[model samples]
Target: MRNINLVLMLLCTTLPVALSLIDGLVPNGDFEEGPKPSQMNGSEVVDPHSIPHWELSGFVEYIKSGQTQGDMILPVPKGHFALRLGNEASIKTKLQVAKGQFYSLSFGIARTCAQQERLNLSITPDIEGKGWGMLPMQTMYSTEGWDSFSWGFFAANNEVELVFYHPQAEEDEACGPIIDVVALKSLSLPKTTTDLLKNGNFEEGPYIFPDTNWGTLVPSNIENDHSPLMGWMVESLKAVRYIDSDHFVVPEGKRAVELVAGRESVIAQIVKTVPGKTYDLEFYVGDAKNLCEGSMLIEVFASNSTFYVPYESKAQGGSKLVLLRFKAANDRTRIRFLSSYYHRKSDFSGSLCGPVVDDVKLVSSILHA
Candidate 1:
């Protein structure tokens, strides 16, 4: 009788304490979490200390357990740390709490390609591209060391694949470096979670241009990742439908826009944009053919008059990525793609043409409420 009484007293004493502990772990005030492990990524990644507690899911290849350089590392100084990769691939993870909200994303990343390869990264549209956007990888991660590449975008959907790509492949000495991690961080800012999406919007594209075919084209059918197979051209279109078999590419010397013309089709919504805010933009222009010249123009702040913004040099010569940032108004802002821009001053004619967009990000540190 005494023993039974003691057991009952102990249970009664610990119940309230246990409940209090669980209450602290519930997300959004939902169900609580039980006990958790002390740490995650026990041995798979490098400098295990850099990575905190995360449940990682990855597609690893050519990974040797004993190799540290070929694994995922963590928390590079805001913008200081950099490493070199040698024929490897991997991605770290974070439990996305704001699963359906759009976030302003920025990170410094690059790869060392001995020849014509590039670094790559990819992601699945969880909730249909809902919370983030990225550019197709093409920057040459030269054999000399590494390069810096970045992009920005609004998440168009959910349940999507997330991937990374590394440039250069052919002349890789023994093995080409996949990519070196710089930093992956989400800036802190206020954004409308509800106002960003419309009718389950999506980034449905892989619109391969038949103009240049150095390799097989992988459409959205491939997992949302930077697969090696996507070596050729890749494009992303919001709220779109793609057909790979009949995809069109502009022919050499016969220049024309692969315009998905019509207002509703070409324009992308500026989700959660405040009336007065500044943002940066970038896209590519390049030789998609042997002797063809192509480029693009971005239309912004146009009050019915198609605004013409052209690509300027920062990297590759004529057709390359151009970046511009400006204050945006609270009202609806229109964005469009213009095929050609004519210089009336000298009668100079040039058009922006490139396989894919690199960075279309909007970011600001000082924001007004």
Candidate 2:
């Protein structure tokens, strides 16, 4: 019967892709699977469904590693292939996810020809009012020519479509960024602890690809509800770098945040407090040991109290503990941290780097005394 065949086709198309919604890379996320020869017109992908586990539109090209475009060799972050999205081009995929849960999408991108490249991300059917976000790519955080970025959103349905679109159309149809390593991970809500702050240890966050050493960037102005850093909010104009112990030096736990954008990068969280109570805010400040050498300053603010902790970095990895005593002015307190100056690698790599913050804790002074 025609009805039976229609049902069978749908199951075959989606079942394989829906297997693991847990952590790690999505199916064919690295673009290791290439399109058939019949589906290609030179480097440009002719068929929309040629790339397995993905759909393409507009002027998308399937680029192999070391391919040349006007003497510029296209570099793939990890695998042998990557997708180049030309002007007005886009690539997307569908997956099964738990409804009402928060998720973060991680991917790597390299600017090829576009001077001002940015991408638009959207999910459907639209769930939480604004099911879309536009990430600005003007700032290059990593010196490796490409940077990994993460975006967080809540899933409103059992199945949702995730899309990455290049909104600006350049003069040349092929002028755009090459994107690879598209990954998705569900975030468990951070639990409250005795530290007076949620996720203060920086343990839970967006998924990091095991193959890459360069940490992921959590974009700026991301609110707490849609932040990849769990309970913290990126309240500045530039993004904050999320580093892991496997690749970079961590001050405390397995994960930490580097305020690489100087004053433009800020992380903050709101916490409940007792009015007129004195508390001690304790945390660790260190370098990621990425050859970033300079005099670093970490500015911290808690309600009416403000303090600056200074650290002299010789490039090698080291950490210092700082304690700030402050009085809570109201029932709620706002805590914030930012780097005072921008820093780059002393090894002449031109990579952005800064101080690392971890193991942040706040407790009543009398309790510890």
Candidate 3:
């Protein structure tokens, strides 16, 4: 009875802390809390630690909703405040994370002045030297003027500092990207099942902001090892949008990935296979039903088989299943998927859209025999 009571007490205290890490945003991540008047020199933050719960350096500006730079009004993705990182500017916050665990950092970003802007993100105490990533802002996928992006990292220590830095030294100090709603979510290592591929259901991924309709974009060339979308490598020059069924049509389950950049957006995985063994790779190709209308084509590459699946999206939610049977020629086989054409919403939102790939499964042919 004493041991059981002690165990109950421990669970009662630790359970909330674990749940809070998964559900709650980082302290003032949305930047809804503003700095005092003394911290301001016009729009530029005068004090490095003026902002609550955040440390800043270089030319960081505290921006409010409806604030204008010239004739352009800066839009905040959520809440009334956002932070702008100017030339070589950066904002950082410390997090208490479980050591050796994987976490995904999701944040909203919008370009203000520079057309070729990009954000440098890193988590320090990086033992493996793979804790940093660069996300390009050259393309705007949503017409909402801002998009949320996610990057995954392995925690090297119990406490880590998450930093977002703008590396550009533009002529205008204020010319940079606006950021808001920074969130961190713990990711479980996807388990391999009867399916040859891990995370084949596209169920595990970065956190999605509930208030925003646009899904999180996983940056290009993300490796399978540290990808925000677990077990899949984004192997193209352009990022792939991770959509949720809450805001967009998902072919199956609650989540899926949209290949929005045509051939430029690709997701792939490598699976161990027995030589001369036959396997069947299956997936669903569909539209997100977010006003994306057209003939969408998805190309699937597996071992020694290549297949093209065409989907005619009438802007209504629907999906078609595709299968590719192949014989494994090596001990390992590479499986990849890419859209053959790019598309935008028919609503003239200029928002990039494409076929969603989900419910992917790969199994040995003998399993069906």
Candidate 4:
């Protein structure tokens, strides 16, 4: 019995390590294994030798967990340690990747000293059509707290060098940006008939709602380039509300999208599709507010065809999935969802109430020659 129990403990410890190896391709990404906290110095620059699985250059500082330097508090975005990139400092690692395959690189970055700091990220062996090359310099300014950022890139060679460097700082001080929780994951290409749209579940976007009263009162509309709903274009004269699982009934993941706060609110995405192929567009439509009277109507437009679907809130408490068939007239198709029905007088809530949408997908229909 004692031996069996020991085996169970070993399995529990080994399972996480095995799963992490499969999920996280980057080694020591969380910076858990590093030099002791006493070795870190605030005034002097440190080398990357103390950190495992990374190569460093220029002036870099290793920040231990719970360590504070002067008025600045060094916080780890993940794990027990993080690296602070001084001006003109960089850290890089070589990764094995398949040529012509796509991958996503994500990391947590925070601004400690300056409001404006920029980092240059690059992948070696530039590929023309695959989009694997030096990424555009990104500027991060998060004085309030740490923020997570991600980018998608294609592998140009079997071995690619992943680099993160802070080229310049706002002032002459050695301080720059703090980085942690680095991760790289390979992405599988969708099949010919699979959906191509990203963030279809409304799960990846601005997480926090602007107004705390969203539980009792609806918030205003959101319409901008970097709107809360990532990978989507929201167009409306009035504001649209971004809903989460805590406040509303999500049809899919922890979050869903609503078309409210405006008379004519629309969310659209342009996707690449095989020309001259028929495709089926599937999505879920429901009522976000129980106070909504009558019925909620939504119009789906794919390519040139349009379909209207309505949902009665009293009949059903949640959402229903609906599918529409359309043909891809060109290589690119504009798929859009528009709120066509709105009755402000019937709704006891003073704000505009409309239909909610979630889990949108578009895939090619099998063709018989």
Q: lDDT tens digits, residues 6-120, model 1? A: 9999988666434422211112111011112343233223332333322222322222213343453321212232223333433334323233433322233333334434445
lDDT of 4 by residue, 268-330 (tens): 878997777898888998765545556778888888798989887652337899989888889
Q: Which stretches of candidate 4 lie over 4 Å from their true place?
A: 1-21, 36-44, 69-72, 129-144, 194-250, 253-281, 285-331, 336-357, 363-369
**lDDT tens per residue, model 3, 250-320:** 98999999999999999999999999888988888888889988888888887777888888999888898
Count of steric clashes across candidates, in order: 56, 0, 0, 3
Query: Roughly what TM-score does model 2 have, to 2 decimal places?
Result: 0.92
Which predicted model would earn the best lDDT? 3
**TM-scores vs. true structure, each candidate:** 0.32, 0.92, 0.93, 0.56
lDDT of all the models against the reference?
0.31, 0.86, 0.87, 0.63
Q: Model 1 shows how many backbone clashes?
A: 56
TM-score of 3: 0.93
Question: Judged by TM-score relative to the true structure, which candidate is superior, 3 or 4?
Answer: 3
lDDT of 2 at 71: 80
Residue pairs in candidate 2 whose N, alpha carbon or C atoms collide under 3 angstroms: none
User: What's the lDDT for candidate 1?
Assistant: 0.31
lDDT of 4: 0.63
On the 0 to 100 scale, the lDDT of residue 291 in model 2 is 91
